[model samples]
Target: MSTASIPKCPMCGKPRSAEHAPFCSTRCRDRDLVKWLDDGYAIPAEPVHPFADSERDDAV
Candidate 1:
């Protein structure tokens, strides 16, 4: 395969390391984790009603 086709580190754009298949180094791996921990990424989701569950209660 061509080097151009090789995957790069998501955080720094460097070639990925064998030790860290998707990241070039532990730093990059940790940084990516930080992004996840800090809520830097978001998934496409349907907007949820704040009171959807409560509104369905028939007991009241």
Candidate 2:
């Protein structure tokens, strides 16, 4: 018989709970959410501006 190891939580170096799966507890889960809400994670991308239909037509 073989048993696979459970992954540690990303926020804290603690074994994950089955209820939380990825996070060890609700506190860690909520902290992750707050980071996302505060823009703690950033993806590199080019800036974009929405154009009005008339403006698009003019450009075309």
Candidate 3:
């Protein structure tokens, strides 16, 4: 199997090492944790309408 190249740290934009996986260092990893705790990032989810299920009765 072929191995993919490691990705850079999202916070610092530095090359990542095997030991750190997606993060370049502990500092960068902690930075991500802090951001998560502070709600710095968000992932949007589909809004649910009150009558959406009834409108799409065929789907169920």
Candidate 4:
């Protein structure tokens, strides 16, 4: 078995619990949630032009 198969807690670097597969405890889990809610995490995307929809319709 590869040790790489084992998952570590994202917050504290502890071995993950089955109950919390990615986070070691509820506290870590909640912290992650709060980060998302507070915009601590973000996904980058290309900006969409407001007239892009109109241009697509004209092409069709």
Candidate 5:
């Protein structure tokens, strides 16, 4: 496949490597891992009331 067809690294905007796949280098891959370990990324979820669990239990 042509390099132009391959997507750029999400971390560095450089060409992606076969070894790293989505990242340009091990450094970029590691940086992404660190970001995840440090809670730099988050998934959104619906907010729940603090007493929601208790309320449900009481209703049963």
Candidate 6:
């Protein structure tokens, strides 16, 4: 059995092969690296609420 049938890079959605499974090419891979360096992406620590936590608690 082989796992070579998958297509497209997971990061940039470009065509992928056995060689580059997650990125289509080195350029896309580097782009992701640059994004990290520039802080272009972020993961939220908690869900945002329009009202402050204290206000919500007071309302209840």
Question: What would the per-residue lDDT of candidate 5 be over residues 1-60, giving only the tens digit for each residue?
Answer: 887888999999999988998999999999999999999998998987999999999999
RMSD of each: 2.2, 3.3, 6.4, 3.5, 1.9, 5.5
Model 4, residue pairs in steric clash: none
Scored against the true structure, residue 34 in model 6 reaches a CA lDDT of 92
Count of residue pairs whose backbone atoms collide, per candidate: 0, 0, 0, 0, 0, 0
The candidate, 3 or 4, that scores higher on TM-score is: 4
Supply the TM-score for candidate 1. 0.75
Cα lDDT for residue 50, candidate 4: 96
**Number of the top candidate by TM-score?**
1
Q: How big is the positional error of residue 44 in model 5, measured in Å on the Cα after superposition? A: 2.2
Relative to the true structure, candidate 5 reaches a TM of 0.74
Over the stretch 1-60, how does candidate 4's per-residue lDDT look in tens digits?
676787989998887888987898999999999999999997898998999999999999
CA lDDT of each prediction against the hidden true structure: 0.91, 0.87, 0.80, 0.89, 0.94, 0.76
Candidate 1: clashing pairs of residues? none
Which regions of candidate 1 are displaced past 4 Å?
none
Best-first order by lDDT = 5, 1, 4, 2, 3, 6
Model 2 has a clash total of: 0
Q: For residues 15-55, write the lDDT of model 1, one tens digit per residue.
A: 99999979999999999899999999999899999988888
Query: What ranges in model 4 sit over 4 Å off?
Result: 1-5, 44-60
Off by over 4 Å in 6: 1-5, 46-60
Candidate 5 off by > 4 Å: 1-3
1-60: candidate 2 lDDT, tens digit per residue: 223476889999788888987999999999999999999999999876676667989987
Model 3: per-residue Cα lDDT over 34-59, one tens digit each: 99999989889888898888889967
RMSD of 3: 6.4
Choose 4 or 6, whichever is better by lDDT: 4
- Measured against the true structure, the TM-scores of the candidates, in listed sequence, are 0.75, 0.66, 0.57, 0.61, 0.74, 0.51
The candidate scoring highest on lDDT is 5
Q: Against the true structure, candidate 4 has what lDDT?
A: 0.89
Point out the higher-scoring one by lDDT: 5 or 6.
5
